[model samples]
Each structure stands twice: as structure tokens, then as C-alpha cells.
Target chain A: MKVRVHVSLKNGVLDPQGRAIHHALEGLGFDGVNDVRAGRLIELDVADTIADEALDEMCRKLLANMVIENYRIEKVAA
Target chain B: MPFTAAVITFPGSNCDRDMAVAIEEISGGTVHRVWHGDAALPDGLDLIALPGGFSYGDYLRSGAMAARSPVMQAVVEQAGRGVPVLGVCNGFQVLTEAGLLPGALMRNAGIRFVCRDVKLKVENASSLFTSAYLPGQTITIPVAHHDGNYYADAETLDRLEGEGRVAFRYLEACNGSQRDIAGVLNEKGNVLGMMPHPERMIEPAHGGSDGRKLFESVLHGLNALA
Candidate 1:
């Protein structure tokens, strides 16, 4: 199975990298950019028998820091 | 009894030697340099220090990987037994990531690496690591890091203030830390994590002696217990 985890800073948490990117885009003369928030996408290849609970555990334990980030899991078609 | 301390060295920890020397000189004790792969700490240690640097090269967030290294498990266990732990800079990040302390160190709000001496006000001078300083006293220490902004929920921040667990606060903005907090103590007051490098300020040659009092305070506190 192929799994993808999307990790992003929570809404209230500040994102300095995202802000820098937003500023860079403005510097390049791009318009209509109100805000920017950056996140990470991690892909994994796991056994077909891997349970959903195990995937959730993976995210909770190591894939994302719950303190300031949230994660979503997506399954890709084989 | 002779004072004893251990300084943990993760692969990229550059300040371990400095920490060891500071502890040895201030406590007049045996200071052991422990490796990250070691499963256990030397027995019956008085203090455990986690020094500053890009541990594990700051991969997966600063101090995140190193917090899970084998040695940290023992560090946590020993800390649970009321052993004093002091973590500076990356060590502060590790302490938060390891759940030994609350909150997290985020990217500096200004989005730049900050390195220089800054003024810090002693917020709580009665902790095991702060007994030598007077309340509200100001001291100078050097802080070098990219992700030093401290973040926690409003409720938690309020609780930390109410409990007087905030150990040091920047007199002027240094890293965009919440409430300008520079250092914090655990609920039990046995653990401290800060962004500034107190070890770097322990001598006249190093710029000033403001940091020496911190080491001395810990030494005197431990001796008192003994």
C-alpha cells in the first residue's frame, strides 16, 4: 500500500517559512496572494495488510509534532 | 561527597565539551562525557546537561530526532527520579520534543538565525538552578539559534507564569519568544531548558561571568541536599 501524510502547522501557529515564501512571491510581482502556509508531504510504501490504526499511530508518534502541526493521511491506488 | 555530572553528546552537539568544563570547574567535580548511543547514564549523577548545536543536523525539526535517541530515554528516567537536568539551545528544543518540558521552539518569528549576547532578566531566582541570583536581576548571556521562538497555548502560558516556572526572560526582544521567555523550569523544578548558553558566559575571557552563578547555584543546591 502507498500512503501519503500531509503535515501542516496548525492554524493558530505561526509559519515563518510560509511567510518568507509569500514575501518572495510578492517580490517577484505576483499579485492576489493574501497569505501562505507551508506544509510537508511524506509518502510511504507499506504492506497491503497494514491497518489504518497503525498508520494513525505512525503519524501521531513520529511523522508529525502534535504540538503545532496537524496531519492527514491519504491512500493512493495501487 | 564529590559532585558529579554528565554531559550528553549527540553526533552534532558542539557545546558538550564546554558544558563539561563549566560543570567541572564550577562544581569541582568529575564530569563525564556521555555518548548518544549509550543506553544508560553513569550512576548517581548530580546534574545532566544537554548542550547546544544542530543535533542530527536539525532534521525533521530541530532537536526532534535526537530527542528519541537511545540516551534520551535514560535521561528521561533519571530526570523522573528528580535528578537535575539543564538543556541549553538545541538541548532546550530536545527537552520540549521529549515531553520533559512543555511547549515547542518554533522558527524565529523574524525568520533569521540569531547569534549574539542578549540581556536576560532572572524571573524566578529560587529554583535549584537559580538560587544564586536575585529576583528581577538582569544578566547577559549569548544565544545562538535559528528556531528559538517559544510557543505554547495561552492557558499553558498562564499556568507557567502562575507557578513561577519561567526562569529567565529577555529584557529586550531576542528571539520572538512568547512573553519574551528565555528559560523555563519543569513543574518539579528539577529540569531547566533555555535558549541562552550560560556555559559560554562563565569566565572573564568568555566575555563575562554572569553564567558562572548558574553553575554555582546548582552546585550549592546539590551540596545543600547532601
Candidate 2:
């Protein structure tokens, strides 16, 4: 089994990198870009028998920082 | 008795020696160098410092890998026992990742690595780390890192401010830290995590010695306890 964790800064947290990207896009003459928030995607290849609780624990412990970021776990069949 | 301090060195810790030198100079004691792989800490440790650097090359996340090292387990236990722990720069990241401190340090708000002296307001002067300073006093310390922006939920921020857990706040806007927090103390006041390198500012040759007070404060607190 494979899992993908999408980690993102919570709403109201300032996203500096995302803001810079948004600025660059405007400089390139692109319009209608209201906002941009940056995040990370991590793919994990684990054993098939890993439980959901264990995966959630992994996210809570290492995959995402609960204080500032939230993580979503997506299981993809191999 | 001279203070007995330990400086934990992870593989990529570049500031461990600086931290040790500051502690030794301020406390007039020898600093024990502990490796990250060690499963136990030296007995009678008055203080344990996690120095700044790109631990584990900042892979996975800043301080993420080093936070899970064998030595950190011992550090956490020691912290729980009321031993003072100061985490600076990457060390701060490690503390938050290890669940020893609240909040996460994200990439700088400017998206560029910020390296310069930043003014910080001493919010709480009661912690072992900040006792030498006056409450609401402003001090200048150097901050150099890409991931120095601090973040926490609104409720956590309120709780920290209400409980007097916020140790330091940026006097000037430097990073995009929520509430302009440059440093914070744990609920017990024994553990502190901050992005500014107080160790770097301990020597006059390094520019200013304003940071010397932090080490002196911790040493004094520990001596009083002893």
C-alpha cells in the first residue's frame, strides 16, 4: 500500500512563499489570482497491513506539525 | 558549585561549540558534549542546550529527524524532571517537533533566509532563561535562518499569552511570526525555544553581549535550586 500526505499551513497562517509566487505571477501579467498558499505533499510506501490509526499517528507525530499544519492521508492501492 | 551543562550535538549541528563556549564562559563550568545517538544523559546536569544548525540537513523537516533521535528521548525525560533546556534556531525546531514546545517554525515570511540582529521584547522575566532581564525589556539578538517564522493556532496563542508563557517577542517586524513571538517558554517554565541565537551574542567580539544575560540567568536559577 502507498499513502500520500498533503500538509498545508492552516488558514490565517501567513504563507510567505505562496505570497511571493503570487506576486511573481502578477509580475508576469497573469490576472485574477486572488491568493496563493503553499503546502507540501509527501508520498509514503508502507506495508499493506499498516492500520489507519498508525497512519494517523505518523501524521500527528512526524508527517505534519499539529500546531501550525494539517495533514490529509490518502491511501492508494498499489 | 560550578554549573554542569550538556550541549547535545546532532550530526549537522554547527553551533554546538558556540553554545558550549557560551555556557562555559558564563557559568565558569565545563560543558559536556553529548552525541545525538546517546541513549542517556550525564548525571547532575544543570542545563541541556540544543544548539542551532541544520540538523539532519533539515530533511523531512527542520529538526524533524534529530528530534526523534535516541538522545532526545533522554532530553525530554530530563526536561520533564525540571531540568532547564534551551533550544535555539534549529534546536527550537527540534523542541517543537519533539512535543516539548508548542508552535511550529515555518519558512521565513520573506521567502529569503534572514540573517541579522533583531530586537526582541522580553515578555516574561520569570523563566529560568529570562530571569536576568526585566519584563517588557527590549534586547537585540542575531537571528539567522530560513525557517524562523513561528506559527500556532489562535487559541494556543491566547493561552500562551494568558499564562505568561511567551518569553520573547520581536520588537521589530522581522519574520512573519504570529504575534511577533521570537521565543516561548513551556508551561513549566523549564524549557524554552527561540530562533535568535543568544549563544552567538555572548561574547563582546561577536558584536554585543546582550545575550550573555540569558545564560547567566539560567545558571543563577540552577544554582539557587541547588
Candidate 3:
């Protein structure tokens, strides 16, 4: 199974990289951008039998830092 | 027993030597260099020092990978027994990532790496690491890192503050750390994680000796216990 983990900073946490990207967009004459937030996408190739609980544990243990970030797991079409 | 300390060195740790040297010079202790792959710590260790560096290339997240290394397990277990742990710069990030400390270090608010001496006020002189400094005393220490901005929820922040676990606060705006916290102590006050590199400032040749007092303080506290 292919899994995608989307890791993003929590809403209330400040995102410096996101802010920098937003500024760059504005500098390039791009408009109508209200805000920008950065995130990481991690793809994993795992055995099809991997349980959701195992995936959740991976995120909680190593894939994401729960203190400042949140992660969502999605199954990708093989 | 002689003052003994172990400095855990992850693959990319650059400051482990500096930390060991600082402990040897100030604490006059036997410093052991422990590899991150080791499963156990030295016996009767007085201190466990995690040095600053881009461990595991700061991959995934700063200190995230290194935090889960084999050695950290032992460090965490020892810390639970009230062993004094000092984590500087990247070490601080590891402590938080390892769940040994609260909160997390984020990217600098300015979106640039900050590397320089910044003033810090000793928020809690009673900590095992800050006893050499007076409460509220402003001290200069060098901070060099990209992800030094500390973040925690309001409730955790309030609890840390209420319990006097905030050991050091940036006197001036250095990183966009919440509440200007530069260093924090674990609930047991046995672990301290700070962005500034006190080990780098232990000698006058390093430009200032303000960092020396921290090692002295820890050694003093441990000796007192002994």
C-alpha cells in the first residue's frame, strides 16, 4: 500500500516558511493571495495489510510532532 | 566519586567535543563520549549533555530523527530518575522531540537563520542548570540556529510559567519564541533545553565566559547532592 502523510503546522502556530512564500508570491505580481501556509508531504510504500492504527502510531511517534504540527494520512492508489 | 558526565553524540553532532571540553574544564569531570546508537548510558553518570549540531541533517524536522535514536531512550530513562540533562541548540530541539521536554522549536519568525550573541534573563535561578546566575540577571550567550522559535499552547505555557520551569528568556527579540522563552526545564527540572550554545562560550577565547557559570552551576548542584 502507498500512504501519504500530510504534515502541517497547526493553525495558531506561526509559519515562517509559509509567510516567506506568501511574500515571494506578492513580489512576483501575484495578487489575491490572502495567506500562505507550508506543509510537508511524505509518501510511504507499505504492505497492504498495514493497519490504520499502525499508520497513526507512525505519525504520532516520528512522522509528525504533535506539539506544533498535525498530520493526516491518506491511502494512495497503487 | 569523581564528577562524571556523558555527552551523547548523534551522527552529525558538531559540538559534542565542545560540550565535553566545557564539562572537563569547569566541572573537572570525567567526560564520556557516547554514541547515539548505544542502548545504555554510563553508570553513575552525573550529567548527560546533548550538544548542538544539525543531527540527522535536521531531516523530517530539526532534532526529530535524532530524538528517537537508541541513546535517547537511555537518556530519557535516566532523566526520569532525575539525572541532569543539558541540551544546547540542536540538543534542545531533540529534547522536545524526544518528549523529554515540553513545547517545540519552530522556524525563526524572521525566516532567516539567527547566529549571534543575544541577551537572556535568568528566569529561574533555582534550576539545576541556572543556579550560578541570579534570577532576572541578563547574560550574553551565542545562539546559532534556524529553528529556535519555541511554541506551545497557551495552557502549557501558563503551566510552565506558573511552575517556574522557564529557565531562560531572551532579553531582546532573538527568535520569535513564545513568551521570549530561550530555555525551559522539564517538570522534574532535571532536563534543560536551550537554544543558546553555552558550551561554545565556556572559555574567554570563545569571546565570553558567561556560559561557564552554567556548567559550574550544574556541577555544584550535583556535588551538593553527592
Candidate 4:
């Protein structure tokens, strides 16, 4: 089994990298871009029998920092 | 009574020696060098410092690997027992990664490494780390890192400020830190995590010695406790 974790900075938090990217897009003549927020996608290969609780623990403990980022877990069948 | 301090050195910790020198010079006591692989720390430690640098080459996130090392387990236990722990730069990252401190340090908002002297306002003068400074006083300290931008949720930030847990705040915009937080103290006030390298500013030859007061303050606090 494989799992994917999507980590993103919470709303209302300043995302400088995202802002820079948005600026670049505007300079490139792309309009209608309201905002840009950068995030990370982490893929994990775990045991087939891994439980959802364990995966949640992994995200809470190491995969994502709850203070600045939020994470969502997605299970993908291998 | 001499102060006994330990400086933990992880593989890639470039500032461990500098931290030890500052502790020894300020406390006028024995400075023990502890390795990251050690499962236990020296007995009766008055202070434990985690110095800055790309610990574990900043793999899997800055300070993530080093934070899970055997030695950090001991450091956490010691900190829980009320021993003062100061984490600087990458050390600050390690403290947050190890769950000893609140919040995490992220990459600079500008996507460029920032290296220069930054003015910080002392917010809490009661912690073992910042007692030497007056509230609202600004002090200049050097910051050199790519991941010095601090981040925390709004509620957590509010709680930290309300509880007087915020130890230092940037006087000007140096990084994209939320609330301009440059440093913070743990709930117990015995642990501190900051991006500025106070250890680097302890010697006059380093351009300024304004940071010496931090070490002196911790030593005084420990001595009073003794």
C-alpha cells in the first residue's frame, strides 16, 4: 500500500513563496490569478496492513507540523 | 558553585564549539561536549545547548533526523526536569521537530537565504533565557539561515502571546515570520528556540557583544536556583 500526504499552509498565513510565484505569473502576462499558495506532497510506501490511525499518527508526529501546516492523507492501492 | 553545561554536537553541527565557548566564557564553568549518538547526558547538567548548523545536512527537513537521535531523547528528559535548554538556528529547528518547542521554522518567504544582523525586541524578560534584557528593548543579533521564518497557527500565536511565551520579536521585517516572532519560550519557560545566534555575538571581536547578556542571564538564574 502507498499513501500520499498533502501539506499546505493554513489560510490567513502569509505564504511568501506562493506570493512570489503569483507575481511571476502576472509578469508572464497571465491574468485572473487571484492567489497562489505553495504546498508539499509527500508519498509514503507503507505496509499493506497499516491502519488509518497509524498513518494519522505519522502525519501528526512527523509528516506535517500542525502549527503552520495542515495535512490530508490519501491511500493509493499498489 | 560552578555551572556545568553540556553542548550537544550532531553530525553537521558547525556551531557547537562556538556555543560551548560562549557558555564557558559566560558561566565560568565546565562545558561538556556531548555527541549525538550518546544515549545519556552527563549528570547534574545546569544547562544543555543545541547549537545551529545543517544538522544531518537538513535532510528530511532541517533538524528532523537529528531531533530523533538518541541524544535528543536525553535532552528532552533533562529539559523536562527543569534544566535550561537553548536551541539556536538549526538547533531551533531541532527543538520544534523534537516537540520540545512549539511551532516550526519554514523556508524564508523570499526564497533567498538571509544573513545579517537583525534587531529584535525582547518581549519576555522573565524567562531564564531573557532576564538580562528589559521588556520592549531592541538588541541586534546576527541571523544566517534559509529556514529562519517561523510559522504557527493564529490560535497558537494568540495563546503564546497571551501567556507571555513569546521571548523575542523582530523589530523590523527580517523574515516572513508570523507576528515577527524571532524567538519563543516553551510553556515551562525553561526551553528557548531562536533563529538569531546569540552565541556568535558574545565576543567583542565578533563585532558586538550584546548577546552576552543572554548567557549571563541564564547563569544567574541557575545560580539563584542553586
Query: Model 1 off-target regions past 4 Å?
Result: none
| Candidate that would win on DockQ | 3
CAPRI quality level assigned to candidate 2 from its DockQ score:
medium
Model 2 per-residue lDDT tens digits across residues B93-150: 9999999999889898888899999998999998899899988888989999999988
Highest lDDT against the true fold, candidate = 1
Best-to-worst ranking by TM-score: 3, 1, 2, 4
Per-candidate DockQ values are 0.77, 0.80, 0.96, 0.56
The DockQ-based CAPRI class assigned to model 1 is medium
**Clashing residue pairs in candidate 1 (N, C-alpha, C atoms within 3 angstroms):** none
Task: Give TM per candidate.
Answer: 0.98, 0.95, 0.99, 0.92
User: Model 4 over residues B1-226: C-alpha lDDT tens digits?
Assistant: 7899999999999999999999898888999999999999999888999999999899767888898899999999999999899999999999999999888898898889999999999999888998888888889999999998898878889999999999999998887888999999999999999999999898789999879999989987877777
- Can you give the lDDT of residue B112 in candidate 1? 94
RMSD of each: 0.9, 1.5, 0.8, 1.9
iRMSD of all candidate structures = 0.7, 1.2, 0.5, 1.9
Give TM-score values for chain A, per-prediction.
0.98, 0.94, 0.98, 0.95
Chain A TM-score for candidate 4 is 0.95
The local distance difference test score of model 3 is 0.94
